[model samples]
Target chain A: MEAQGVDVVVLCGENNVAYATGHAAPSQEPARAGATRTVAILTRTDVRLLTPPPLDFDDGVRELAAAIGDHAGTLAIDEYPSMLVHAALAPHAPVDARPLLTAAKFVKMPAELDAMRRAQRINEQAMDDVLPALRPGIRDTDLSALFFRRIFELGATGNTVDPIWNVLPTSLADGPFTFTGHLPFPLPAVGRVLEKGDVIFNDAGIDFNGWASDFGRTWYVGVDPDARQRSQFRRYLEIVEACRAIIKPGASAWDVAIAAREANGGQPPWFPHLYVAHGIGTDSAELPFCGTDLGAEIESQVIFEPGTVLVLEPVVWDDGHGGYRAEEVIVVTDGGCELLTDYPHAPYE
Target chain B: MSKERVLDEMGRREVDVLILGREGNARAVSGAHRLFLAGERAFSPGCVVVAETGAVHVLSVTDFGVPADAHLYPPSWNPATLVGRVAALPGVRSAKRVGVDGITPLFEALLTAAVPDASLVDGEAIMRAARRIKSPDEVDHLRAAAAVARSTMAVALNGVARGLDDSGVVALAMEAMAAEGTTTAAFEPRISRAGQRVTVAVGVLRDGWEADVTRTAPEVDRPAELVAAIARCHPGVAVADVGADVHGVGCGYEALPADERLEPGMVLSVSVAGAGDTVLVTEDAPEVL
Candidate 1:
């Protein structure tokens, strides 16, 4: 904000407000909600958060405008509460600061990184605990619930993103894969029962104290070695290698994405494209998203910088079988990228 | 909805076309009428334009196959792109006054530049009034959603043990809801082991309707005064003035203002609005739908 010459920033988005003030505004729970504009205004000298009674929201908002007087300069805001924020800061426009804040938060502080590491421990524990229980007849949602509950047990404040269960049928045949979207939705367990020899290829981002840990593993349901299974799993390792090879401080977001796709023998992505790499800190999905058009990024070409915590999720797939996506969180360092979460993809390594 | 009623309201406000983009308003309007507008599921600042003749044209993200009759932008399209798309829709070009539910600052700029001649008025109150009462089908969806939640809580609580942590209990509850055919749980369930305090919120999406409810632990019941104050909220009374504890529970988990009144069959999530121990507005007392 200081670099952008933003005189006073009024944090309206819940996540941004939480990031700025360490105070989470009253959320509507799984929805962008709150009646009164309990906003945080950051001036050159002081910071103010005016929370109004739900009844006196209009009057409270009127006061918000008065607080943001004169030095309107460049106010940054998120899109959800853009209407109310705009109404309150009328005349003084709020540029969408999501991109700005997202970029700024890319370099985690030592304490922030420590918190992220602690968050990954739950995911590590869940991966270890759930595998032994994996077998035929387990519903996808149940498995999701089991893992998610494990994370909660590990002390996750709340999950910014939901646990994804893209469990495939035993037969590796042509069909729609149940991969979760980029949106932070925790898909309640669905009733699709797993069959013998089925592969549970899942990905999830757990919000541990607002820090997201993205990691997942692929497992064969109560089965032994098979040529087809081994070959499919090999492709995932290749993509991971491709991402790691170029994930240095100076790497380009687009180059890493193209590399991962090409690593799968030049196959077009199932969803047109995949965000092979994304920064996660305050919000589950943050800036420096590689492999896709990062709209409104301050930088024309997003160069990787040291301290950038990236979730390198390179998905590799084969024909007639479901895609194998392994999300390994990494931090870009002065020399190379460090693996933050190394939850294994295969039984071997 | 009575198209004539909406058209009448639009005429009174001198609005040729009422453009609604806010999710809450869009869902409320769509729930009232069975015609689900794809634009309602769109990005903020996107819209469903209700024409003066009662025809609805939508502009939303492309992932959702917007009806062949409506407009669709790429899933990656932002609000500014949507504002332009909404203005170019068939009816909007000819319309004189366009009423919008709400506008972001960036959106306000993009809109003013795009439709210099058009008069844009905030039409939230008008649309709210139009879609105030829940239709029978909407009521059915809400009922199914509520029923699914009740059964889910039953199954979850059945599996709970003294040693189960917050996450484990939540998992059991979610597993039950998932088994019962629920896809969305409007909000994350709140669980704490100290007093076994749990606020299990279930918002199920069935037949394109989202019915929401929250269930707290049996031990921690809400104050009787708070519950009574919430019950007093009716179609004309502002809910906020009733009491500081008053909250909206069903559909969207938002807090209503002093002016936003509760209508009959509006599934509210006021501390387990549709859950056990909740009352439905009646001449006598509460009854399950």
Candidate 2:
């Protein structure tokens, strides 16, 4: 929000609320699905949090209030009882802090950056363990279980999201696509054994310490690759490499995306492409997305800032085959960007 | 023997033999020793006991198929075949099935088919009572799982910064965990914005269980003052009192205590929210595992 020049940020997302106020509650009712009605007000001189009764009435809130009281005056809140803030400040004059308090949290600080880094490290470890277990004859459900177990064993509080396993046969007509694109579905069974020539794609990520990391990779299950598969894989890799090549401190997101599109010769009926890359840090998806059509310029954009983290994915679809996508996480540095993933770009048998 | 003295009087009972089912029952009866028919069935539900002098016999009804040498048939199956088989077994005195409520209906049928005159026993409470104490191995697993959770938090904290979206942050965190060899997250990561505050929820499962542990870091402006207030939150003070004096709380985890007293053993996740910044504190040192 600070980077975007927006003040008095009003966040409705659960994770965002948690990030700003340090208090998050599980959705008590169904209507609150995908919504957590917690609010944090940050002003230059004071910070206030306004939340539903479920979250405010806790010892943690007491502790938070004490922490905030040391810093500023004139506690301002929306729904919280004004009396509570006033009573908390006995000797001091009660100041209404609504507008000014809401404007302060738009900027990012160093300590928040440190916390996010720790979250990323935990996520990377989960991916490392999951990649090797991708083989034939393993049930997707079992794989999911293994993934959960591994993440726990590795010391994460729990997964922030569901593990996704997609196995596609070399013959695209056979149809290995099984995801329903819904939540809470059971893991797929490993009923069919992996054949000698098959391509398996696994898209997975983890949530650690209230932060999240998501990445995708496609692997060759067996030794042989036909000409089409090889060509497709090569093109995908080329685009990924090209995307990374021009990602510098000053490069525009538009130019970076156009380079990828041009590399594909402006193929007709352009593959259903999402953003080439998105900012990642405290939340899983940030702003300043890399795409051709967005009116926002890439220069000095929020997404391209130094110290920003991003996920870069290049995708392509073949009529005979389903689709192929490869993604990686990169942290924008002063000079360029550093790739955080170790999944090999070369074909593996 | 008194009910409480059952373990002390194990050998004093008149019954010569004892039979138990698989898994839970097998463990209760033998304490880590494998039963004779361990490998025969997918789910174990059969136990047979042969008595001596003035003897007692025990049988389990969960058995689907058994050798001809066995004297009991599950009650639900045909009684005639069970009687004929029991009568044919050598030195079989009185054959009976152990009847227990809460047993699956299918097992009850098998027991009824095998033994017509079996004694029913209510052992559900006894079985449950036996499992309350944690074994040495169980404790070790719990501690190990907690350690794993702590370390994963470290990895997550490393990549967090301003401007990253929820999905991007979660993906990076997961990548860090994967790099450390974890294949899954414990729970769904919650990342969103609520009225100017950015929130991140790190949910990780530990030791085959999901702990809905959450941490919230509210973005704030005055870091120095927030830090001063947190520094004052020592043992034996009301957190609410502290908040009354401080301007705001930084970002971290929130716990609602049942009482006003803060004890040493109790774990509390503390968040100090400031403008654009948040800090997390816990009884455990702030370092990622």
Candidate 3:
């Protein structure tokens, strides 16, 4: 903050608040999250949190003003509660704190990495309980039930995404029409019954001590993958290896994105609306986004520093047949990168 | 029916356009089942409602649960790009008043730059006014959500009986809720054990409506203060008199003004501190769901 000449920093996003103040409440839907939101304020010398009662009843403007206590310096905030727009922060012309926060969260410390690893371990172990039941005639929500139960039992703090067990159609035309003309993925689970030859794209996440874990895989129902499905998985693995080969301490996100594209025959092997890879920490998807619509200029600027954690998810779509997809978590190191995800590509391998 | 109500409210409030970032507000207006993500998303125009055309434009990449005629815009990581997309919506350029449920400094600046003539106001108030009174079908959805919550609470109680720890009991309850086909929880279960008594607060969202309840294991008697507060849940009763913990329950934990009078069709979740129940205000009596 001193380096940027920012005197006061206010954080309103739940994960950002947790990052700044070490205070956490139960994870919730957006509406409830707004009603029960907390704010953390940090000055050059002190950090304070305005929580509950006063913040709720008074709309947080008065409470935030009181917490700041007359520092009359440049203010920066990740989000602005509009009630405070003119009342509390307009005078300071609060600037966007996202860039500074993003830079700070770009690389993980040893403790944050350990917490993320623990989170992923719990996620994988819970999936261990969920996969055995992935037979024909099971509802999508049934898998979610088992995974949710096991994660909490394994000491997970929160469930991040709503456990996607999306069944893919054979071709792009058979699926819902997407604006990008590419494959649509990761639709929310709606209790659809599994059929004999369904191809399931699984994605879910959980949190352990404020760190997030993302788990994704492609599963075959009731039988082993056919020849074409195995080939798709091989292509997916090749794309992942191509990206992994260039992920080093000083590599730009563009390098990794280009490697994946070249391996996939010069086409982006990821969802159009989504990314080939994303960074994860307190927030499920944070900085170091690779191959997103944020534009190529920004992607080139996001350089990988040592201790940067990335979730590389490459989708290998065979237009006539169903596709293959999975997520691999890796941490960039001085020597190269180390894999954090330890799940198997069972049906394909 | 809900969209008509929103349109009516928009006319009454004299707001020409609504750019909603809150999921509950977006779901209420668009009737689209977008993906459920936990925590606060950075402010962006997730849904846009135009008064002139009565059209709902949702920020969705695919037409999964979206209405066929609704305008769709793909997701962008850049706020400037999103602002440009929203600006291209019909009747947005000439809108005199634009309401937003939430805003950030960057978003507000971008919106102002995009539509320089429109005045930004509190769209959240308009949404609350439209959603405060639940229709019969909305009430039915709320009742269904309440049943799921209560069933999950029962599973948590069962875990407490088996001497499981707090997280273990939460696990059992969450599993039970998902088994009932409700995968999204309203919030993480707040369970803590002190001595022989355990307090369990569980909430769930089925479709879009919400049901939240708090209870104690081993069945402790309801406190007199809570009972008195719940008794005031009747038509024409001021919400402040009802209690601070009492909040309107519908798509989300709807916020009602403390000075506002309780209406007959409104549903309320009264949590006096921690233990409470959801009730329906009627012409004569309040029925507990």
Candidate 4:
């Protein structure tokens, strides 16, 4: 921070807090109105954290200003500032430090990489324990229940608060259903029953300790996948493999996307900005995104270095075949990429 | 009461448009209160653009989403693409002044470039003020969620085991909710182990309504002083801060302070660890629902 001429850095996001501070600092969940919100400050010499008084302040803004005092060269996380924090600190012209922070975070510390490896291990083991229990008539929620139970058994405190757990059939994969989301439907993992030939396309995520794991997979239920299912599924898995083969230290983030797009049969996806691959660690979707959606200039500017963990998920969306997206977490290695997640890419239990 | 409060508060703030910004970070997967007001549920980042007159618009980005109505963008809107859509919002595009639920330098820059002349102000107070009141449907959802939470807690803590870790206890509650037939556990089920300060904050969603309740396992019995401090709570009664954990749980988990005066139909989870039963404020007394 001093080298960058940045003075005090205010850490608000949980992951940022965890990155700067060893443990995940408890920040108030921002789901409510007028609840006590916490913010932490990191300076050259000292670190201070502040929270709204527990029902004490009539003018919380005034108190927050006093707490902030007169720090001029301030830097705050753009993604997690509160209204008061923005209003009060805007005048000081705090440096938009997200880019700087993201850059610093891209090259993970050895411990950070180890933490991610730990998180993915628990995530993969949980999937392993629950896959064999799959049947034709099981409800989506039943799968979620067992899958999550296994995660806990393997040592995750809990999954990320809004992790996606969609369990739908291949018939509904295309236009009608979203394969990735926390609450894609009115209810998550309930009432929806799976039948034979259904595809369990999951983009579920979980948090172990403060680190997070995000990956996607598609599994066929009781029957062997038909030709249409096999083709669509193969398209996505092949793209992931193709992208995986190209990733290495010193690869351009944009070239990674363009080459992956070419390997993905040279056509644009139904939607835009859906990266063929993107970096992931604390945040599921971080910088270094590559795909046809990011345009050529942006793709050319993205470069990957050693220690950066990225999720390569090539999606195939056929209106008739529905949709299929399988994600794999790989770390940029000196020679090539190392697969961190050991979950199966094949559509099977 | 549904959206009129938003308009009224915006009117009071003299803001022509109110845009509720995204909550959490890229990895944080929760909706802001704006989504609740707009009657939309999206896990990804989105914004609710509100007019001075309470007209609400939702723009979301999801993998394969089709909102029942045509409200969702056909190509769905991600954060990168949302700025253009937000700039195009009828109320926002026409506004001379705008109020945002929250702000950041990056978002402020986007807003400034989008609406050059519009002055931006904080709309957190206005949004929070409007969120305090619960509609009939909201109350029912809270009740249903509370009932499930109460049962789940009972089952999990019935014979509390020392071997259970944080995730294991949460798994028990998730299984319990599933067995009871509610798919959405409003928030992710949380369980801190016994020695690490056992706490439970469950946000369960039914239909579109959410009920949130948090409780910490009793460590040492709070002496009579702490118990007596809470005995005075009732409907239409002002509450001085007694310092024990107190918060109101409603449409978006918690939207009211614990020390505020209780209103009828308002449900609160109050205790040091959020373990206190939810109390529904009524015309006369605060009923422990």
Each model's RMSD to truth, in Å?
Answer: 5.6, 22.0, 1.7, 5.0
Model 2 over residues A169-283: C-alpha lDDT tens digits? 3343454222211111112323334554456666555545555566576666545556777778788777777777877666766666776777767751122223667665434
Query: Candidate 3 chain B, which ten residues in sequence have the lowest lDDT sum?
Result: B217-226
lDDT by residue (B1-289, candidate 1, tens digit) is 3244556677777787776665555444433212221111212444455554466554332222233444433323244556667667666667667677655445666777777777666566566455445556656666777787667666555545445655666666665665554534554454443355555544444434455444455543455654665566555556565453444433443444556665565445444332332324433443343
Q: Which candidate's TM-score is highest?
A: 3
Model 3 chain A: weakest 10-residue lDDT segment is: A52-61
Higher-DockQ candidate of 1 and 2: 1
Model 3 in CAPRI terms: which quality? medium
Ranked candidates (lDDT, high to low): 3, 4, 1, 2
TM-score of chain A of each: 0.84, 0.66, 0.96, 0.84
Using TM-score as the yardstick, the better of models 3 and 4 is 3
DockQ of the candidate models in sequence: 0.24, 0.01, 0.71, 0.33
How much is B143 displaced in model 4, in angstroms?
0.4
Quick one: best lDDT, which candidate?
3
Give one digit per residue, the lDDT tens place, for model 1 in A1-349. Answer: 7777777777655566667766643212332334443567787678888765431246555666676677747776554242343456656756766566766786788888887898787778876776776789887766665665566666666544434566653333333222232221112234677788776666665656656577767777778637766776687778877878888888777767777778877763323323667778766666777765343252337788888888877655554655455678888888878889856655756
DockQ of candidate 1 relative to the true structure:
0.24
For every candidate, what share of the true interface contacts is present? 0.18, 0.01, 0.75, 0.28
Candidate 3 regions off by >4 Å?
Answer: A52-59, A84-86, B220-227
